[model samples]
Target: MGRSGSCLCEAITYQIPESSLMEAVCHCKNCQKQAGSAFSTLAGIKKSDFSLTGKPKLFVDKATDSGASVERYFCENCGSPIYSALPSQPDVIYLKTGTLDDTSDFNPSIHVWAATKQNWVEIDSNMPQLQKQS
Candidate 1:
């Protein structure tokens, strides 16, 4: 089935095209901070496959490691993070997986930024954990 998601307030909704790419979870410190959790789950989709129904406020944060600029889009009213786009990688968009209607099927093929992960967070032993995005 095709994937669809929306912001916390439901003001912003999006649909991933059938040909969209897979999803992944990022364990980077910046992702953790932005998500206010152990990690951030993102559905990587083509730029054209993703569309926003509402206007979201954008925040630009510089990556600590790569020094690349990451754009975080969130709901202005609810302050719920919606998605992210990196300057270094312009072809793809990382949609916040939490916003998806069905998260049961979503899985992370690899974990990035595992070095900065929280001590209490336990990751799957089978998945490849990289110190940083490779």
Candidate 2:
């Protein structure tokens, strides 16, 4: 079996195979705004291993610090973000870890967009940080 998750209202559900490419924290302004938090916890899962049920509304965000369009998918019923997709990496989707059924195992190996990270949120020195998306 794989890992499972759903939106706050259970309007959208998804399953990702037990393995993921990476786990990280995003401090990009857009991600922070979308998550309504200081940062967004993300898991990079391959598209082929991801399965979804229910229709999520898609918002094409054009105004971004990265100057790239981001396809933001969320549950319309509760406005809970589901995942984000980038055109540059069509085979991978950045999953919003907050929606996961169990997040105890989630550990971010890196922090991206540290340039805009909120000063109040101190990052662990042991974790690698990037000023921008790699």
lDDT by residue for model 2 over 44-78, one digit each (tens)? 99998889999999999999988999999999999
After TM-score superposition, the amount by which residue 38's alpha carbon in candidate 1 deviates from its true location, in angstroms, is 0.8
Instruction: Please give the distance, in angstroms, between residue 55's alpha carbon in candidate 1 and its true position after superposition.
Output: 0.9
Query: lDDT for every model?
Result: 0.83, 0.93
Model 2 alpha-carbon drift over 4 Å, by segment: none
lDDT, candidate 1, equals: 0.83
- lDDT, candidate 1, 4-64, per-residue tens: 8888888888888644476677888888888999999887888877776999899998755
**lDDT score of residue 24 within candidate 2:** 93
